[model samples]
Target: MRITNGAGLPAINEAPGAQIAEGPAIVPRSASAVRPAGDATTLRLSHAEMQKLPDVDSERVADIKAALLDGTIVFDASSLAARIARYHGGPQ
Candidate 1:
């Protein structure tokens, strides 16, 4: 189902003196609150912090590169595309 930008909204906000009564805020006023989209994404990791990263495997990567260079490994494009599509819940 596709949702339009004006979904759940009236064609015109035809109110002159509409006042929202005082209530608890929908979002909290905190320093770590979520920001709007298109903000600059930055990743600042210190040496000790970077050492704690889980997904970086340089030795395994070097082995894979060597295998690919020596033609011991085959790169299957169709299988890779199918896996990516399944991962993103797209057309299989």
Candidate 2:
């Protein structure tokens, strides 16, 4: 169930075809760009935003869990995999 090879990432900077472009790295900042740092930031939680979260259906969840344990639930691995791939911007 685990893919150890998938964990390895190619180092693009050290790759054979990799190129370190030599150009102006730092962009010129405007005079107005330098501003004084503000005071401690205050995080305000919106009640409207909090209320937008969907309420959990405890009974429905329990039924689904029981069905899974009893092997009564119909699960399509390919369909679920496709949905997961689509969600992660992977090939369908």
Candidate 3:
């Protein structure tokens, strides 16, 4: 049955109870799926690539750890927000 709308467009919503027969169900590969040996290749980042990460001063790290131990440490949300904003091109 051809169903048309006010604008003479094919009314897709009119065929509500229509059932279209489909092919066999495709079973997806689970976590235990057998993968090819060479397909699981991972590229190891070099020392230089890892070294490009942000540098943290050892003294500041120790100070933060000390503060955490003494219950005087408070996380600065703005710092993380700024970092995330910088990551997403909001600000640097």
Candidate 4:
């Protein structure tokens, strides 16, 4: 049987108790079978690639920790308000 929508497009029509046919069962590949040796597609990170990451500034972190302990850290309210406004697409 055929069915048509309000836009006059043909749609599928199935009986109330009709069952859909199942497709092929998916089988997962074994761990070693997933990747073979000397595969060009495989990615490897070298020592230089690891060194490219930005190093944490321990001195600045210690200063921030000291300010937090002494309650000397100051936050800009106007800058935070502008950022919130921009995120919500409201007035600048």
Candidate 5:
């Protein structure tokens, strides 16, 4: 069911000023904390670099390269741990 404002208890905004003591004063935010919207930089590959690379049409290679460039590609910790376990065989 759709219920409008003041359906139950008294509306907060409509309440008396004495009932609502002033809340914590808001401190003005510093300029440094607010970053500009147009301040961001865009990344691009050089034309010469792109020309040097072959198979640009390959989706798999392009995806891998994009992931690496964006720092999304990470080392497989579980695989590394298993490999290390196999190499060590036992505790030192």
Candidate 6:
């Protein structure tokens, strides 16, 4: 999705390790000069970088799902109600 500034110009979205041009000429303050039509840039994460991320604990997720199914997961009803009331600007 493209984000626009107050002038409806496409916002500059920079990525890490990306080379950004220095000087006012390259980085224009005006909306029209920022990016012309047909100019598209894509950002992607490398496979090695993606591999550095942590894996989800499937066993723990399964346990939580089972607990939820059997209604064994405990919840504070009064606390939840108070939060709901606060969110709705009602009396706690």
Best by TM-score: 1
- Report residue 74 deviation for candidate 6 (angstroms): 2.1
- Which stretches of model 6 miss by more than 4 angstroms? 1-29, 32-62, 68-72
Evaluate model 2: give its lDDT: 0.71
Task: Give the Å shift of residue 10 in candidate 5.
Answer: 3.4
Q: Candidate 1, overall lDDT?
A: 0.71
lDDT of 5 by residue, 1-92 (tens): 22247568655556365454465667678998986764443223455566788766598888998998898997689888888988889532
lDDT (10s digit) by residue, model 1, range 22-46 = 6765757786676654353323335
Q: What is candidate 6's lDDT per residue for 2-73, written digit by digit as tens?
A: 345798654567456666665565544788657654344222345557677669878899999899889899
C-alpha TM-scores of all predictions? 0.36, 0.33, 0.24, 0.28, 0.22, 0.28
Q: Give the better candidate number (4 or 5) by lDDT.
A: 4
The residue pairs in collision within model 6 are: none
- On a 0 to 100 scale, what is the lDDT of residue 22 in model 6? 58
Local error of candidate 1 at residue 30 (angstroms): 34
Task: Report how far residue 42 has shifted in candidate 1, in Å.
Answer: 30
Worst 10 residues of 2 by lDDT: 36-45
Model 3, span 1-92: residue lDDT tens: 34567987757655678754566567678976886655544323455576887787888899889998898987789999999999999968
Residue pairs in candidate 5 whose N, alpha carbon or C atoms collide under 3 angstroms: none
Q: lDDT of model 6 at residue 35?
A: 69
lDDT of 6: 0.71
- What overall lDDT, based on C-alpha atoms, would model 5 receive against the true structure? 0.67
Better of 1 and 6 by TM-score: 1
Query: lDDT for every model?
Result: 0.71, 0.71, 0.73, 0.74, 0.67, 0.71
